[model samples]
Target: MFDSLQDKMESAFKNLKGEGKLTEINVAQSIKEIRRALVAADVNYKIAKEFTDKIKDEALGSKNILKSVKPGELMVKIVMDEMTTLMGGQATGINVKGNPGVVLVAGLQGSGKTTFSGKLALFLKEKKSMKPLLVACDVYRPAAIDQLTVLAEQIGAAVYKEPENKNPVSIAQNAIAYAKGHSHDVVIVDTAGRLAIDEVMMTEIRNIKSGINPTETLFVVDSMTGQDAVNTALAFNDVIDYDGVVLTKLDGDTRGGAALSVKYTVGKPIKFASTGEKLNTLDVFHPERMAQRILGMGDIVSFVEKAQDQFDEEEAKRLEKKIKRNKFDYNDFLQQVNQIKKMGDLKSLMGMIPGMGKAIKDIDINDGAFSKVESIIYSMTEDERLKPEILNMSRKRRIAMGCGHNIHEINMFVKQFEQMRKMMTQMSKGKGMERMMQQMQQKR
Candidate 1:
């Protein structure tokens, strides 16, 4: 998401290279470049200036304190610290601690307000084990209610909607009472959004907040809007005085000015970030991890957390036994792909690994590749899937016709599968890694 900004920041740090220690001239040059980069990313000019000025002061102050550390490295550390503080130093949790916690969501139309409501419901239901009731208070649009209903159905959460009622305040209050009666611990009130900020919209949302007295009020903003997002957030905060901000559409936000400037401008922490359209793509905002990401240092902590979330201890044991016996077949391969799909988008997941983001920046890797393999595997018979070795020339041609692919594609897939199985078996035996490295070196 911060691809351009990352590149510019790297260039700024490179300007300090070959310098023994931080100097006024070198620090000023780097600071000017950093400020330009931030401004080009759509960050407010004043905010960028202040942010980089702080970095410059820190750099000059620490010149002799850490003589052994490289100037470029020290400058990076200083900028990272300032950026973290600007984005709200640590993560902030949503306030859902009431008997029936009410979280009122307000945003502009098409800001992904309803989608985020669904994601938040799913996150709470699956991760927090909370019974979240999705309240469709966006009574202005009939489609809004239907959207929430569909999302709730998919997430396995209850939806409280009064389609006939046009009063959002009444609907929100009623929904909270319904939550209390249904034993739902959390009530997420999805308020109506307008195409632009207007008095009517602002008053309606403020009234809803006052009527429900929600434990947390979040303003959902589209990060793709750049500085406009910051302005909208501030306007909303002035009226509703929201507890936190939810930045959506971050996967499409290349500049990332909203994430970097929202907290500093609106005086609210970005509690969560919604990336892709997937219901499982919502993540709690971590400023330090984000800073590391912007500086080309991948967020390994977040990467591991996602892996642990998708990890199945019992499934791991079963897969380990199968791999040890060389019994991993197409079915197991398909299952593994499905599990990885649940982890999030393939490209974004790779970006979380150290140095992998830049390595695959221009690569077009998508789930479609996995889907092709799945189609091939699904075309196979039960016996063939269990024992891929049974597939001969006739069997491959038949499978190719079944999956609508060429016989050559089938042959290549089968050969790759066999090689993968052999490699995995050797690794399980603790002898393949060294031999594999030797073979790789020889090929090089």
Candidate 2:
């Protein structure tokens, strides 16, 4: 996401490498490079300068206090703290708390507002245990209602839209009333967007906000717009005074300017970040976690949270029993793969692990990587899926033809699956660790 900025920041830290302590000379050299990195990431030069200046002061002030810490490590700590503060020190949650909490969504054209509306509905539905009504108030664009309807269908949320009603304010008010009658606890009103800032769009959005009296108003912006995104946010805030910001298209070639500068310029916390096109890819923005990722320190906590979301306690217990009995078959394997897919894209999930981002930066890992294995599993009959040992040579050949894979590929997959099942059984029985210790002692 911020690959270029991450590389440049790494280079900046190299200046302090092998140094005994932080000095004015080395600190200035590093700060200059840090400022250059921020500017290259499309951050405002003025904000970058002020940001690095704070880092310089912090580094110099703590030079002697932490003599035991390495020079490079100390500088990284100082910069991480400053960057977290620059990006709104903590996560700010949206207020969806009312009889029927209303959220007003605003942004420029092509900022993914409608998509985010659907994602927000799914997030609230799955995470917050609240029923969210997706209100399609974007009456300007063609088929905008249909798009929202499709998204709402995907998330299984109720959508309120007046196909013939052009008045957004009335549509929003009516949507809230509908939500109350339908027992929807939250209402997300997706409003129209403009190609550029204009009075007409502003007035329409202001009127909608006034009519709905939303518990929270969010300004969604395309993060790939760089500093222009920040400027647009400021313009919108001046009009409607949004409660928070939402950064979309964060998985694109974003230079990190919008995320780094929006809070400082618009005086609003970034409430959410849309990493991928998947509705499940929405994340609550955490400034400290983001700073760590920008500095090449992966967000392990977020990775765990994503996994935990897909985790089912009863399913885990069943799978554990199966593995312990060496009964983990194609069915179990397929189920595990589906759960991982629900977490997010493989590349993004890996990026959340510590030290995995740079390792996989150049690798072309995606959800497609699972297609071959899935095809193979899908080719198997229900009986074959439930029983691994029943696959004979003839059965393997038939399955290979069904899955469009070669016989050798099917054989290799079967062999690997058996090995994995055996190892899991052994581990569950406490024999795997004991065997590993014996092997180590024998090697010694």
Which pairs clash in the backbone of model 1?
A: none
Q: How far is 290's C-alpha from truth in model 1 (Å)?
A: 0.7
lDDT of 1 at 394: 96
Alpha carbon deviation, residue 240, candidate 1 (Å): 1.1
Candidate closest to the true structure, highest TM-score: 2
Best model per lDDT: 2
Model 1 TM-score, all chains together = 0.95
lDDT for each residue of candidate 1 in 1-444, tens digit (9 for 90 to 100): 788998899999998899988999999999999999999999999999899989988999999999999999999999999999999999999999898988999999989999999999999998899999999888887588999999999989999988788888888888888888889999998988998999999999889988999999999999999999899999999999999999998777469789899999998999998888889999999999999998888888887778778766667667777888899999999988888888887888889888988888788887575888998999999999999889999999999999999999999999999999998987977855446444434443
Candidate 2's TM-score: 0.96
Query: How many backbone overlaps does candidate 2 show?
Result: 0
| Per-residue C-alpha lDDT of model 2 across residues 1-444, encoded as one tens digit per residue | 788999999999999998999999999999999999999999999999999989988999999999899999999999999999999999999899998999999999999999999999999999999999999999989999999999999999999999988899999999999999999999999999989999999999999988888999999999999999999999999999999999999878889999999999999999999978889989999999999999999998888778777766667667777877788999999999999999987888888888998999889998898899999999999999999899999999999999999999999999999998888888979866446434434443
- Report, for every candidate in turn, its global Cα lDDT versus the true structure: 0.90, 0.92
